[model samples]
Target: MNDTQSVNATSSNDTMLVTKQVHEIEQFETFGGDIIKNVRVGWESYGELNDDKSNVILITHYFTGTSHAAGKYHPDDEEPGYWDSIIGPNKAIDTNRFFVISVDSLVNINAYDENVITTGPASINPDTGKPYGLSFPVVTMRDFVNVQKSVLASLGINKLYAVAGPSMGSMQAIEWASAYPDMVPRLISVIGTVKADGWTTATLEQWTTPIRLDKNWRGGAYYDQPPENFPNEGLAAALALVTQSALAPNFFNDVNAQLLAQADGKPDLYDIQQSPVIVQWLMERARGRTTSMDANHLLYLVRANQLFLTGMNDDIEQGLANIKAKTLFIPATQDQLLMPYHLERARDMLKANDKEVELVYLEGDLGHLEGLSGIAIHSETIRAFLAD
Candidate 1:
């Protein structure tokens, strides 16, 4: 049989078709002492499950991502999921060898994407028959991991070969190893850190500034308003900030003309209301992406990221000491957002505990996003780590 035939994937053409599945919980207790009822989330899986279920790999997505980790739901689609580069038959993740599953986080930023099924501020409150909005309980990275644990339990797969993700997915991966070290044997964190530091926490909070300042946001109560009244502009601006933060200045330079060229081509001296070409370009992209996202959900995600602390509590050192999985961290060499130092700090703490950990740099100018779009650069590294 050919390589594709040996795997659960459809064809050797490298295009796989997958379906989104749903998981529900009657009541979910958050890490912050809040209880959410009738919770449901969307999940998708690729590859075959071994008889012993020992080859399961859980892929937790980044802040703006969904469960569609790889494959196209439709054949003619222009783009696949975010990490399609490294996940496929004979690819780094190699669906032929492992069962890969990715789930949408509660309050996922892509909540409005038709492909995403998540419970967040935009989801209706079972108790009030209204969108949860600001009323939704705060959920942290640990809370996201706990919800994923329940999803795994439902599948009768209690143990994992590895839990991997990029950015915030990195947080969930570390949280999984911390909360259930015995259940996970390997952990992969791409552009991730074990805990959110003070500076990092404050930086994340900046993304929320635009959303709150939009008067139409109406304190996250605009869900019932007219479509035009929704905080689209605010959300768009907020997403622009996020987009700028995720990418490196160098990456932008490669795709767009140099700032000097733009300055000479266009007259910036005439109109004070006019924005720079690069900034305008970023805003347009953000506006398009946020057309389907919720403003309140963006705010909630920022808060959730701010609340992340390895084990979701004090004494992060103790939490680092709790992990049992073999760990690998791939931080972008030029990442300005999470910064490579995030990996260094985690590496130091894990070493203090005598944990088996290794570090690799994702060499690219995409900055923090190198982990997402540049993962192919280190696909072999991931394959070997998982195999070992």
Candidate 2:
């Protein structure tokens, strides 16, 4: 057994506490042919590991999310981890039976969060002792899995019972199944696409345009700017695109309809600069998401996603054939960002390659977000798949 001490991470109530741990690699190489030294990433685990370390289930987090997948950090915290609904004692992920692990991605956007520890553009360069900024080497989905693989290896884990994630996390999961076919035996991809299609890649680029146009962005060298001069507007705007794309219109109608008008009983439409309450709501939603986000990091994330292809292979079919894991796809039917067609293509490709694949749709108006918020509705499906 590994020498690491057991820590309680999965709980159904506030009494359980979760602690963040960091993993460092002396030097790391990027798929794009760049070298980074002293790579560090934060990770957390839920449940206990069995003998031989074979009960491990790796959970990759989505973009805009951290490594906190379940449990509360403190007794009085406002909420547990994001996926608490399906990762507890008797939940779908069933921490009682599976040792679930999650890691923070390199260049994670939530750099300001106290619990997150990641290396990225905001990290100090050991050579120059300054933030890397735009000089940071480009990273991709494959890089994420590689780092995760290193983490698992450090824990003496050579095989994963399952590798599962949603959206960007799903991309990482797919990469794991492809890159290390022998290591991962099961793949659970929720609200994911096989590859970044042309339409989706362009849309992701559009999300970054606001940040690039921001006067304070300064070609991603705005780290020295004071908080007041930070590119909050651009980051918030970019987040708004992500938020709206992940959710359906009903969310706006339900949450922002009453605030659409001014106290004077007038609509917010008289001037070109005056935005409706819904628009302002979007901005505030993004603003409150985490103001410490770096614009350069956002741009890098966009590029990483844009450059993603099935297994990073020139031929998509050959890449799909590399997967040896039994795959389960749970896609949100109303997802706009990664539409049903995207998952369909992946499922079809896996089937064409004679891989074991199963698909179940999540029916909800939350669009892409259903993979998170509406996942519990399909708990039985997940439980059965894991059992299989």
Candidate 3:
């Protein structure tokens, strides 16, 4: 087989196929008492916007994603959406009937170009008139949703066709349904549980370690020199952690193989000297993140995920009771990262709440990636659910 074919052969069966773009938005607020007046959000849309705008689908992004969901920014572009395989024309998302939208999460630190408006520790504080850096307030999923909520309000949208996402993004999606049950009609959570597990909390800290150790990090104040020139050791380490096990174990291995092939067979070596994509970006960016956000916020979002007792009739059962929209929970059968039981738990929770919930177990070796890579396996399922 040719090199590209060989690479494709080892890839997870579910791959995205669509065009995407990075966009920016301005003037947003968060629950953490911080207001980002000019927020940069990279976004992508699929299908035409209906005249009533009721067909709009909002996709919440994970911690590291930009708003580049599906289709190319321009006709000649080659890159597809991170989850393109599942959402497009007649694909799982069924662009023919719905207008799909996905936006970059707050403080997104990926390969997005500078034109995308973003605010993190890297952004200047409007109050002090200086970069917030480590001084930026800590944020949470509610804070994130608050910002997106502002975006939706600006567009005159009071309700959403659906709110969907994975991993950290899934946490926000669930919160959107629970926190604003009056505004959402459906929730599609893949390979994500209601609460952040201890396993996740511990693993997430590794992403923050690298930035803390860099001398140039200057406690998040190295704005004068090249931000890229600053110590990226922490970010590199964090990237390695993600590259290794953030997704399903088997799928992680599959992607590992593809990434290795892209590196011409040199394994375990990320391009650090030549790029900022190494594992250290985690630490460099996470320095102010942990503190800037309220410890209560972390406890809230995480506990909300962990406490996602969908089936249990306990305190705040009213929240689950209020989720009137149909729900779909897709879990990776072989997923070691999230474990099949986690999604099962979510299914049970919603069912116990007497909510209309459907469970679709994705079959693939891609583990957690099944949530994304296995989009083809879910096209009919998603279409059917959305149609209802």
Q: Which candidate is the best by lDDT?
A: 1
Best prediction by TM-score? 2
lDDT of 2 by residue, 229-314 (tens): 87778888899998998898776677676674534454558787887777877888788874657778888888888888878977
In model 2, what are the clashing residue pairs, if there are any? none
lDDT per residue (tens digit) for residues 162-267 in model 3: 9888766777787788778878889988877765557766655555555567676666566666645555545554455554554555554565556555664352
lDDT at 46, model 1: 86
Model 1: per-residue Cα lDDT over 142-252, one tens digit each: 889888888778777899999999999999999999988999889999998877789888888888988899999998999889878888888898898888889998888
Off by over 4 Å in 2: 1-15, 258-264
Q: Name the 10 consecutive residues with the lowest summed lDDT in model 3.
A: 1-10
In order, candidate lDDTs are: 0.86, 0.85, 0.61
Question: Between which residue pairs do clashes occur in model 1?
Answer: none
C-alpha RMSD by candidate, in order: 3.9, 2.2, 9.4
Q: Please give the lDDT score for candidate 3.
A: 0.61
TM-score, cand. 2 = 0.95
lDDT, candidate 1, at 346:
93
Candidates 1 and 3, the one with greater TM-score: 1
Task: Tell me how candidate 2 scores on lDDT.
Answer: 0.85
**Which stretch of 10 consecutive residues in model 1 shows the poorest summed lDDT?**
1-10
